[model samples]
Target chain A: MTSPKDNKSQIWKKDLPKHTFILLVLLLELFPLYMMLQISVKNNVTFNANQWLPITPDKWEWGNFVFGYNLIMPYVANTVFVAVTGTVFTLVFAVFAAYFFARYKMPLSGFLWAVFLLIMLIPGVANIVPLFVLLKNMNLLNTLWALIIVGIAGGQVFAIFILRNFIEDIPKDLFEAAEIDGASHLQQVINVVLPMCAPIIGTLFILEFLGKWNDFLLPLIVLRDQDLFTIGVGLIYLDGEYNKDYGKIMAAFFIASLPLIIIFMFTMKLFVKGLSAGALKG
Target chain B: MAQPISYRKALNEWPLYLLVIPSLVAVLTFSYFPVLSAVYHSFFDWRGGDAKEFIGFDNFTRAFSDEQLRYSFFVIFILVIANVFKMIPSIAVAVLVHRLVSENAQYYYRLLLVLPMIVPGLVTLFIWKFFLDPNFGALNAFLDITGLKTLLIWLDQTFLHWGVFRADAPIAWLSQPKLIIPSLIIWGFPWIGATGVLIFLAGLQSIGTDVYEAAELDGVGPLSKFFYIELPLILTQVRLNLILMVIGTLQGFGLQLLLLGDSGGPEGAGMVPGLWMYNRAFGAGEFGYACAIGLMLFVFILALTWVNNKFIRVQK
Candidate 1:
């Protein structure tokens, strides 16, 4: 093995370059975020003057954020309501479904699992037309429930796929032990499966939340009222309106992004762990 | 492994059925019903409202001969190809991160990489929209500042004969026809997203230290060592990512939809199948035709996925 002293000396040749390269790439990756943050605090005039460099503190336009916050906060509220409700329902259904698949084998088990798995193959882009029609027919056309119900249906899938594997991998005796204590079917799900699978579920929760939060197409199609618009559709509207005002538009983008930032700030560990588990990082 | 619950015993467990039904009904009504409904409507001349006329194979035939649709496929093909090259940077970064001697550096680099992802994807999209704005965009400003715009103009004038880059006017990246696909390709520069890097890193990190030690004993150089050992070892992750990128790139139109509008930029140059489908359904109210386009996309995506699964097994 090489000596630690030699390693320290030659580190300048090899390791230095690697670090510099990584740092450079990291900065590039972070460029958009930098652009968003810097631009958010400037008004139309100052922004018109300098689109590339940071605006000085003297000219910082906190009013842009106030404008953005007033404009999009309702949509933000709508999104939070939709995303949370959608994520919770999606997880509940996914857990129940995954638990069903994992714990038991019935005549229709393969067929049922096939029903779930096959839907994964259907490019969701293809089905949007019909789904839009469906929301209309179901009287969910202009309502937030449209997003909630559809999100529950489409988003549960990856979670179910992951959770099934997880539940199946959980030692069977734990379920048997819970059952001996008179755990009902629901109780076993709550007590036994939930604990063992909490980490995976947390991962699924974040994924579902992010997916719902980012989804604009469904909201665009389903909701007609501007008041009911989610952040995705709302942001598009904001972009259209504020095309001349980069500061306010960037502020809107920054504000729309905060919920997720706050969420991951707490759940970053679980999120990273879950993604790195080689699950539906897609 | 636990024994499978007998069919009879499964029937006895009727209470268990409750858990599966909500999910089942939701899937049936929303997911499966939409597929069935889309298939049914693909053959009709149905508007989004109620008017329907059964026009068997007409939509399909229209799609077959549609020139814009044809152009869209060509554009998507280019995008898919560009995406293949884009996969390299993530792989390279993963390999570099994997090779880092300091654990703390590796951890911090990974943390830095992941931090950008917390930004909502749409927010990122919009920021890029601003970043690509012709007169006001940072890209044009950067090019102007660095004199690359001048160089590009000279090259275009002398050899290329292409007229995209000009010294006087800012390059209209999204609005210009010739630049749309190029803009789409270069939308996310240094496209080393955390999901890609981390997945590849997971695969790379799984490699035992002894393998590297063995390679070191044989005096293997870094480049060949990468090719023969590191690259081959992470083939599974690479293949998985390639398949994902292909499928995603082929099906995606949101970026186009956001950046280029429903008509898909100038001359419809950035139009892909998905955006074409969206245009048909939403723009023209050709729900039936859009469904047909979507089906056609589904078939291609399914075939590619099948081919990837069947023939491209990596040595694990």
Candidate 2:
């Protein structure tokens, strides 16, 4: 395309500004995280010294890690349970509904699609009142099942919409061929659509998992039991009790962020493929 | 081709209907039911007894007149202004990354931006809380090292208003009423960076390369290219971002609770609608009034979004 790029140095020079800018932006974006890491390593005594430098020798507190884990173990367990159960429930319903929307051109299909869009537009806070009443009347307060059910239901619109978009992109000819081979709709969905929808399904799983994991408001309202609190809820309550305990509070914060950061680091490759991973999912 | 099936015949697909039933029920029961019921709940006054009474127009009037509720709008307004500076920087950084790097490198940066999104909110709060600590914070130390002694008062209201932090020194970070919203704005930058950058980056990716190539051929420089080609292309995204921010402010609760430890951070400067609702229900045990406030917020957000949609024409 240009002077037969024979030298790496020349190519690198041509891209220097862009590269520098990217590095700078990445650092800016990561500054707080770097600070978090530095603080996590240092104890309250070292933090009180008010130095910008990382704990050289005196402030190091690896004990915070063990203590933090012990403190947050139950909350992490609760979070995992909700995220997994919610994802499972959402995936089951979303996949079926997405398949129906994508494959068949039923009457009122556009209207149904519009309904999903409308749901997406409305803020989640809008429904807090009646849902609270409904759950309370049904004797479901402070229960893990309440979270699981509400989370799965609350996230349907975007999940269905995204799954439908991805599914629609799958060539219709493939589904037609399956039908011609004497496959029923369910079989076609399972055999043909499921595999093709893998990337989207993966994206939705992570999205839903993140949503349910980071959810604070719903759980704050519904769950009164400390043990029933998910990570977000648990973290709020934990910090409230130990606000000034910087080492332990920061430790708890670090622990709460650990699972997600780990997942993201491992899955960084997937996010780059133009994936719509931020879409809210049930 | 086979004769077209009747619409009635198509409706007989029991399996299809059955498959959609679970999701339909979930959406209707959880989403639709509550939305309608919130509107219904707004009109009635109940004090948790058999003394339920229809008090049409009363709750709406109260929300409008209530000083605390009215005061929240000013807080929201200030917060929006502060976000502009931070958001502009984030988007500029994001756009610069988009321009300089190949798709692969840009993706890496994008992932970096999303790191905070995945981080639990509690973690972010703690990180910022520590960072903003005036006595031993990296910020104040750096300011002193730079001979900008005024920076020590970065957290003070008097210094913040008088802009004389270096002189008087060491303002209460959370105690001042005027400075509280600004403080929230500063803290919000990192939190917003995670999701805001992602959405904008996605919006940037959707701009067609051919348009840029065409602009280049037309002798358009970088600034012109961004203004003419890129900016207009992402107008819908801007509208989306604004609407999201507005609605989010209306729903702001958890952040304040974490930051201020439940008293709304010095003079109720940081009190927002969502936190107000929480206080009413849980703190004051006025479930009926809280429900009314929640309903009002819902309507207000919906109306705001609808107006924004009308103005922005959400689709290009």
Candidate 3:
């Protein structure tokens, strides 16, 4: 019912505030990252003299990256191994458990789901002491397997929660049609349930990967060897050793952050979708 | 109700049970067993060594009477309160982002907001640690350049009457007891993380356009529409976020440990209970006492979660 000119004015009025707010927030969020990048490329002398200046070509010290990479590359590789292995194991177990919970009849299903819910409610900090003891008793301390096993177990509850909901919402007719074609329970799970639940599975995969990759405390406790350190634990060590060397510290931070940033750029939509769906449906 | 199933039916259902066994075993070993162990160890005098004595209720009583533990409780209380207030700005940002008219603009803003999250949390803490360093910190450099350093020192002197800094000296943010908590609170200003905004935006998007159209036809202004419609609809997300923030603050001490170490900074200003528990168990080898502290925190979080559930009923 409005004229085109009036609508145009209203659009301008609405967008001006929105644009200003968004630009301000974007700057605020980017400032720390910009600072980190600037410091990473500066030499020690220049960095000490001018802490706030952006690095020029003459002042840029590419050696900082070399030094940091030499120091922490092994830890980064260790983290990649743990994250991938943990995510695969978590997804495998979660898919089976969620399929069972969602599709098939089981005794004490409600009670078992309640037990999983109780597991979710327990504070993670409470488990650390006992988990440390348990791992030591099993002679798995300082090993990558400890991290992988614990990560899989910790991540399964949330994964199963999401995947169960996703699988349950799949059309019931699909399973019936598969059954009529002589698809066994295992066949239905592999052929129908897995294909239909791919989106949620992908979401859970990224979530679990990110959790394992960025995890600090458990790895700090369980891993004692320098070679076994995750990137997070390595960064703490780097921070301690290079406390006064801002250039090297910032370099370490930048290198440690690169993988996640790359993954996030490619999977931005999925990441957002995963977070929203987890919060809304949880 | 007592009817027996056929063996064939039972055989056919066996795969489903088998499929769930690994997860069951993992949880039973890693999650449930640890919890049981923690509870069992709380009553003992077991350290890391083999020697153990069953000291019933001693650890719990000692924890209750310990002065440092009481101070830690106070510190955690302040942190939780600060975190609760911190959500206001996050919610405001989410509301602003949701109000953007253009879909492309909304998408871009959401992307920018979430982009910061890609930086690992430890990296963020480290960046802040350097950013808040007394000398050569970005914040102090900015303050010096803008002629605000003198003003800040004067304000500190006038309010606290300490005169601890020279006119040219930069403020030691993390080193001073008075400034540590405030520094921690203000570490990430405009504290709207991506998870919070995305969750709030999801809640907002779930509201039907027809509701807003009707409101517009009824001559409701943007503020009224927000308060009467949008805010009410997003309360569910808000409550969920509140519970999460509470649990996170109560259980998380990684930032404190990273920033201040086991000493918890000057005068124990940052000695949260979680960090206390960690230091007691691992640093000092007081495993049983630490377990008692952990169990106490568990009960506190459980009670708070229960209260939130009972009291903060979401609007239909």
Candidate 4:
């Protein structure tokens, strides 16, 4: 907005203080990550010698990554399964619920929509104890299905809320046109709504996926077997074992974060837009 | 808006309910059931099984006098206070990034801020745990390298002595009772949450360029520009983030549970209401008491949110 041609060279100096301050904050923000990467390549001896900085590439030890991979691979798989399954399950339920809410306004339907909206006001913390007991009574304890079921149920409120907004915004003619083409309700949903709300569904999927992935206390309480451990609980156990082996622990940390980072790399644009949208609506 | 259907027509459209039933059933079974059961069970003496006896208000009476539970609230009070200060960095960074002359620089900054978010939150907690390891942790290493350890020792030896920061050993951050709260406070150093910054940035995006130009014409200084223009404009975002953080901190115990154990650090200094509920339920098998605690927290949060809305909304 300023006269850019008048002081083209001054932009750097003008923003120097802001730039320096932001970069300083960024340094602190990224410090732990840098530390994790540095220690991930250093063995015990080298870690002791140079805990201050990363060792040279030639001096780097690669065994930590291999060992970390072998150690946490099962847990990572368990987490990926839970997160993906839960996200899909959440999206499915949410899509159906959202479609009904968006398409109709019968008295009963309106009452039901109010119930769903009120769901947000209920504090989840209060339900933790009873939920645990419910899971227990359902014979769901120590099973990945417990996590998936609970996650799917807990995730419905937000998904339905956001998806309803997206689905309603969609032009009504599309659904009507599909219906005239002899499309059943399900077919209309699949062919018309799904394609139109694909972006929002992607956003919902990523958000719900992250929610399931980072979930700690539920998995910690539900799963008794190390084999059933999600990444969060798995890391806690790994930390207990590898407290001294900073290299392996950091490597495991990196390994656990790999799927999320990869997902983010592909969906960074949607991720940003989604976060902003979430705030605006929230 | 959704189109309206007549009741007679709605009667014929009963099958449409099939689309909504699955999610409704799941939520009712898993979510609503627990909530209703928690309310029902809070008045009974239950051990997380079929055996239960009606205790009326005994659990509530017990929670009112519980020492650890009360102390956990005190601990969270300190944390919530620390978090108010913690929010400053995100706001500042968003403002600074918004002020950047070059759009390209702004994009890179946002990208860099968001990149760290890919590391799951659990991993962040784990890394912070690593960073605070007394022996070889980043904090201690930095202290020693900067000769600040000597300063800490001097402070300990002189008027302000804690005895924990002695010359004989590395500072045990997680173990020391006195340092536990401070350590908790400092867990996410420079706590510029990428999501938080983005939220604030989204708010700042609504500010017009002409506003800044008018301020410049009025000879408004940078600090006043921030205080008078940028901050007030972003107050809604700030208020939203504040409400979220408070509710989050109130319900959160994962950080405490992960860094400090379920017992909540030395002398249980880091214990929070959520963690205490978990400990009581899972640790002591005091399921009834834990439900009471959870209900208590629920009421407390509801009250705080009501207050937040009243306080912030009126100002707006």
* Runs with alpha carbons beyond 4 Å of true place in candidate 3: A1-10, A180-182, B1-8, B145-151, B162-168, B207-222
RMSD of 3: 2.8
Which 10 successive residues of model 2 chain B have the least lDDT summed? B151-160
Two-way DockQ contest, 1 vs 2, winner: 1
Q: Residue by residue across B1-316, what tens digits does model 1's lDDT show?
A: 3248877787888777789899999989988888788889999999978889999999999999999999999999998888999998898888888887778889989889999888988888888888898878878888988988889899889997878888768898887798898899888898987888998898787777788778889999889979998887788778878887788888888899999899998889889999999999999999999999998898889988788768986454
- CAPRI grade of model 2: acceptable
Q: lDDT of candidate 4 vs native?
A: 0.88
Q: Please, what is the TM-score per model?
A: 0.96, 0.87, 0.94, 0.96
Query: Residue A142's C-alpha lDDT in candidate 2?
Result: 93
DockQ of each: 0.69, 0.49, 0.56, 0.78
Estimate the TM-score for candidate 1: 0.96
Give the 10-residue window scoring lowest on summed lDDT in candidate 3 chain B.
B1-10
For candidate 3, lDDT tens digit of each residue in B123-148? 98889888788877767777788988
- What lDDT is reached at residue B163 by model 3? 59
Question: iRMS for all predictions?
Answer: 1.7, 4.0, 3.5, 1.0
| Candidate 2 chain A TM-score vs. reference chain A | 0.84
Tell the DockQ for candidate 4: 0.78
Residue B118 local lDDT, model 1: 87
**What does DockQ come to for candidate 2?**
0.49
Clashes of 3: 0
Tens digits of per-residue lDDT for model 4, B112-221: 99988888898889899888989778899888989999998888789667788887889999999989998999899989988899998987887888898899899999
lDDT of 2 at B314: 71
Is candidate 2 or 3 superior in lDDT?
Answer: 3
